[model samples]
Target chain A: AQSVSQHNHHVILSEAASLELGCNYSYGGTVNLFWYVQYPGQHLQLLLKYFSGDPLVKGIKGFEAEFIKSKFSFNLRKPSVQWSDTAEYFCAVIPLSGNTGKLIFGQGTTLQVKP
Target chain B: SQTIHQWPATLVQPVGSPLSLECTVEGTSNPNLYWYRQAAGRGLQLLFYSVGIGQISSEVPQNLSASRPQDRQFILSSKKLLLSDSGFYLCAWRSGTTGNTIYFGEGSWLTVV
Candidate 1:
């Protein structure tokens, strides 16, 4: 079975700190990558997505993710994170081979940005 | 623009009681609907997905079941709820044309005591 892995379970950072959340997948075939954020008591929102082309993709709220096929990783990064950026982050993947629209999500990382 | 809505934002039920969570999508047709369970440290578990009306695919076999009676509506239900059924439920949909991204709803919180 295919799986998505987010190594970080919990992280704490002060405001304006650099942020990087690691994400990795099991499959090597063609895949779509996504980063989603869930604020406190809120639904999940798309942060960034990497389908094809340029390894690096930019998303809302000054967040980006780099899709490294060789490493089988699509890591989320932000130069400076704010308290508002504190949220649980989740990574998702959808395999395109004989696709049936089944999406797999990671365990999720809880980021606490201290003010 | 498209949006998904889930009902019973928060509910508390006793074990052995029936469960029904409804979801509806607006501004899209022939969309693929899905039901997910959000559990601690487990990420988003894909419970059921539908490509068309009355066509449902279940990922995990559990006490829960799903039904898609309409093209843009999906429902998750259980004949008898269990204590383990207490968790957050999310409804999502993706366009058959774009089919690449899935959007989630506000989610329903169910607590079985």
Candidate 2:
């Protein structure tokens, strides 16, 4: 079974502050990585995903993530965050095999953006 | 546009009571359905997943069970609810076609007192 670990549990930042959240997954085989965000009272939205080709993937809301195979890590980053960026972030992964598509998620990082 | 619907965005039930949460997806067929539980301040735990009707897979043996009656409908049921089951229950689906993006529902918050 694959597991995802997120470094930060909670983060507080003022408007316009740069942001980066660390994520590491334990999967030895081919894997697909994703970064999801859940705003207050909203469904989880895809921030970005890494399947193949181009280790760097860009997502909605000016979010991007880099997949490093050797390190088994896919970290989310943003050049500048705003107050609207406050949300709960989750890192998820699934094996590239076709048997099952179940996702293993990280503990999540709560980001509080203050104006 | 494709949409996923989950009933009773918030639920409150007493311990030992029965539980049933329904989820349906529109604009898709033969989709892969999944049931996940998220405890407060915790990660998502996969409870069940179904590749097709009458094909259910249990990720972890616990107090919850899931069923897929139709191609786009999935249900999570419990014979007796437990306090530990108090959390956010999410139903998600992915296209049967070759893709890795999974869409989550609005989520059902269940509170077992």
Candidate 3:
């Protein structure tokens, strides 16, 4: 079974602070990784995705994630975060070998950016 | 541009009541659709998915069921709702011909009392 793990449960940061959320997946084959964010009273939106090629992928809202195959990790990072960045972040993975296109998501990490 | 919509934004249903949640996708054809449930303060759990009309897949054994009556429409239902069924229900879709970047709908909040 494929599963995702996020190390952080909650993180508090002041505005303009650098941010990094750890994500790891358990899969042995080719995998697709993604980071999704759900703001308060908003739907889940795709932050970024890693399908092939570039391991470092940049997404909307100045967010980026790097896929490290060796460690099976795809950690999201932002050089500077604003108060609007507060939301629940989820890490997801889909193993190509399964061919089911089903996504396995992590428990999620809540980020609170204070102004 | 593709978009997915799931409705009744919020619902308060009594236990043992019937449920029918509808989801539809626009601007895409033959897309893969999925139904997921997010319990309070928890991760998204895959409930059902469909590859095409009349095709459905269940990921977890529960009192809920799903159906795909049209190529772009997916429905989740239950004959009798349980208190545990109260949660946030989300509908998502992914391109069948391109990358596997799944997009989620606004989500529906179900509160079973």
State each model's CA lDDT, in order: 0.91, 0.91, 0.92
B65: Cα error in model 3, Å:
0.6
Please state the error at residue A74 of candidate 1 in Å: 0.4
Question: How far out, in Å, is residue B17 in model 1?
Answer: 0.9
Question: Where does candidate 2 clash, by residue pair?
Answer: none
Q: Over the stretch A34-114, how does candidate 1's per-residue lDDT look in tens digits?
A: 999999988799998988999999999999999999999999999999999989999999877764767888989999999
TM-score of 1: 0.95
* Residue A99 alpha-carbon offset, candidate 2, angstroms: 2.2
Model 1 regions lying over 4 Å from their true place: none
Docking quality tier of model 1: medium
TM-score of candidate 2 against the unseen true structure = 0.95
Q: If scored against the real structure, what TM-score would every candidate get? A: 0.95, 0.95, 0.95
In lDDT terms, which candidate is top? Answer: 3
lDDT of 2: 0.91
Full ranking by DockQ: 2, 3, 1
- Candidate 1, DockQ to 2 decimals? 0.66
DockQ of each: 0.66, 0.73, 0.68
Error of 2 at B111 (Å): 1.3
The window of 10 residues in a row where model 3 chain B has the poorest summed lDDT is: B94-103
- Residue pairs in clash, model 3: none
